[model samples]
Target: MSSSRYLTNQFLIAMPGLEDPNFFHSVTYICEHNDNGALGLVINRPLEMQLGEIFQHINIEHADPDIRQIQVHLGGPVQQDRGFVLHEPLGDWEATLKVTDRIGVTSSIDILQAIAINEGPERTLVALGYAGWGAGQLEQEMADNAWLSGPADPEILFRTPDAERWRAAAASLGIDLDLLSGEAGHA
Candidate 1:
């Protein structure tokens, strides 16, 4: 596929018609997209877990109550045990995928440590696991109308409340999701 077809630094808003429980009304931030596959993080599904809990599990010291209280999101159904930090400013890290000039997804302890110390990026979204698609899988899903794709906006990823991201992301594309039918059909 050509670069124009790639979805890197985009948002995949799950269509109302999509029945997949894992992605119903989800807003995913596409971090990487290529011929090999696509990788993203679901930004709207917050888990019961918190950053403090993860810090405890990882044996890291988190002294900031605000940072510790930050909710952790369920990024996807895959690798549920792992953690990913979607942050802005793209700081240097051990393992980070630079999605764009301003954003990156890091899966390293160093970033967590920085966050714990109040030295991390200006904004962040912590999540577990990630959404992945094999070669051509995401393209096929797009063709089936399972998702609405558009350029990703950092405001939606970092500042929007989890409950509002789905509609907000769709609205960014001039779509009011509530007005769309829940059933998908081809013309």
Candidate 2:
């Protein structure tokens, strides 16, 4: 809403005063943002389960020892039982949303299977569920100063630890979130 431009492939960092339990101190990676609606995944809320457990539940024998212990994340509140995989390289999957030239989201079982066998994209963030907003809903929220949109850094998605992602994403804008007041205006 700031300039009539969409926030596709951006990171929506929760403001200091965000009271919503689902979004407080959260960092969401916007996979698709446009005229109809927007869909994203919370990048920092890791669930109790790990990649190995998820693969087992789905009856897939995971072969990637390096990522077997990688914890899955709670992407958002909606579709809590469904799984989403945010990765790079825009590979051909049964169902996918190309977020940017370097990022893509896949919800297909095939992609999961590929990942279990170590044949998937080089980097992946396994998450359950996703965040969704109706047409103009996200823009309105931004207008009300509920969030801060910034460039999506793949490092935050793949490298940074979850406990620190919220602060790190906010810091990516050169503003220390800890120093911000609870009562903020437009971001």
Question: Clash totals for all models, in order?
Answer: 0, 0
Off by over 4 Å in 1: 183-187
Candidate models: Cα lDDT each: 0.93, 0.90
- Score residue 65 of candidate 1 by CA lDDT: 93
lDDT of 2 by residue, 20-125 (tens): 9999999999998888989999999999989888888889887768768978999999999999999988899999898877789999999988887778998999
Writing each residue's lDDT as its tens digit, candidate 1 over 1-187 gives 4599999999999989898999999999999999999999999999999999999999999788998999999999999999999999999999999998889999999999999999999899999999999999999999888899998989999998999999999999988888888665321
Instruction: Sum up the clashes in candidate 1.
Output: 0
Give the CA lDDT, 0 to 100, for residue 9 in model 2. Answer: 84
Model 2 whole-model lDDT (C-alpha atoms) = 0.90
Best by lDDT: 1
Cα TM-score per model: 0.96, 0.94
